[model samples]
Target: AYVITSRCAGFKDGACREVCPCDCIYDAGEQFVINPDDCIDCGACVTACPVEAIFADIDLPAEHSAALHFNRAFFES
Candidate 1:
């Protein structure tokens, strides 16, 4: 899964959402979140992210690791 980081907070650009083949990205108020289960990890959203906030789970920077949890929380609820 590619998690959306805080750089997207208040931007929520639709580019990522528009290119997501699985339609797994969603507007989460403050930002957009990718649905891990539904995501095929195709990485389409990563390139479409205007703020460069998308990152694969394993590649997620430690400073932005909280986004992984936030992405999961969005779907869990």
Candidate 2:
């Protein structure tokens, strides 16, 4: 599943929302969520997040500083 990471927590800038071709990303009270089932893994949202909060699950940084992965996965499953 695709995941969003800490780099983009509580972000509402919505550049990602505008760019997602599949509309897989949703706005949460705390953060943005990527619906894995709907996600085409197009990586548009990744580039859209100015904070760099989006990443593939396996691509998460070693520091684990963000909730992007957890937030996306939490709703995905």
Candidate 3:
């Protein structure tokens, strides 16, 4: 799964949603979020984000690790 970090909060560019083959990305209130269960780990969304806000779950920065849980909760709720 790829997580959308704070950098995407105000800049929901949405390019990631457009290229996602699985259609796992969604328009959350402040930023776009990826559905971990639906994501295929294709890495397409990472390149599509103009703000470079997407990162593989394993590669996420320490401070941005919370984004992973946030993304999961988005879909769970």
Tens-digit lDDT string for candidate 2 (13-45)? 788879988877787656677776777877887
Evaluation by lDDT, superior candidate among 1 and 2: 1
Q: Which stretches in model 2 have alpha-carbon errors above 4 Å?
A: 65-69, 72-77
TM-score of each: 0.95, 0.73, 0.96
Computed on alpha carbons, the lDDT of every model, listed in order, comes to 0.90, 0.71, 0.90
**lDDT for 27 (candidate 3):** 89
Better candidate number, 1 or 2, judged by TM-score: 1
Worst 10 residues of 3 by lDDT: 1-10
Q: Supply candidate 1's per-residue lDDT for 19.
A: 93
TM-score, cand. 2 vs. native: 0.73
Candidate 1 clash pair list: none
On TM-score, the candidate that comes out on top is: 3
Model 2: colliding residue pairs:
4-68, 4-69, 5-68, 6-66, 8-53
Worst 10 residues of 2 by lDDT: 64-73
